[model samples]
Target: MSEKILNLYLVIDNGIIEEFRACSYEVAGSDEEKISFLKKNAANDFLSSFKFDPPVSNSGKKMKYKQFSRLEKQGKQFLLFEEIFQKFQVPDSPLICLTPVVDGEILSSN
Candidate 1:
């Protein structure tokens, strides 16, 4: 039997999607490892397709890399939620609020 794997879908606001399928054994119960894997493998394509405005803090300033890393972790959480919602026929919501420009067309998930 083929082993079941977890699929991680990264969707840009422009409706571009990049999917990463990883074996459950690869993560080995480490969220950090999973995030690292996704970032290393998929971040370039995902980021290239969409403009990422750096997240801001309550102080209204751009957050640092550490904060961005935290956001990456949060993204993984949202990915799981989206996966579940998709399976149950629930409308999937945008995990991040951003306007994606694709092929001279502006797309917004809102």
Candidate 2:
């Protein structure tokens, strides 16, 4: 059986997307989680210069390592709302993020 996974994908146009993924899969689902996941990953050089819209939240409740996931890749092709031209940017501001909350399976050891 395939395991459910939450994939956080960031794209950079370099002809080849030099693989820069989680240093540790222990990352959780809360914003309280350090986004430095990027800053600390190998893509830091290309990502360091751009500014993201809507100040991110590094506050409130926190989850333990490997406790939460959000890409919603539950063996499906689509999940929510209006058509978009991009896979990364929101169609508009996520001021309320009416989008669904996609909590995937917890990290498990078999």
Candidate 3:
């Protein structure tokens, strides 16, 4: 049987991409476990500068980490993340995209 797989993508300005892969077999069975796996296995450089938060409008509001996992699972776009990338001057303004890949398919980037 083919196990579920997750691919984490960090897209930067200048069209540079960094990818990290994790298979269900290697990670725990729970959603939280999967997130932990990605966190632990993600690149140090990515993690060092990574920021998890909603957009500025939603600032001061707390978004649950589980929501991020859900977005990944559903292959939904994260507008706030895009804004964050823009705020940090990730190169191409709003072109810095981050998305999750399931199996061999890439989820959409909002």
**TM-score per candidate:** 0.25, 0.19, 0.29
The runs of at least 3 residues in candidate 1 whose Cα sits more than 4 Å from the true structure, single-residue gaps closed, are: 1-48, 70-110
Tell me which of candidates 1 and 3 scores higher on lDDT: 3
Arrange candidates by TM-score, descending.
3, 1, 2
Clashing pairs in 1: none
TM-score of 1: 0.25
Ranking by lDDT: 3, 1, 2
lDDT of each: 0.36, 0.26, 0.39
For residues 43-107, what per-residue lDDT tens digits would candidate 3 score against the true structure?
A: 43243444342322245544344554566688664443454434443333222223443343445
Candidate 2: tens digits of C-alpha lDDT, residues 18-84: 2212121234444323333323443323333222222122773332212212323452212321222
Candidate 1 lDDT over 1-45, as tens digits, reads: 122123233333233322212212134334545445434444233
Query: Candidate 3's error at 33, in angstroms?
Result: 27
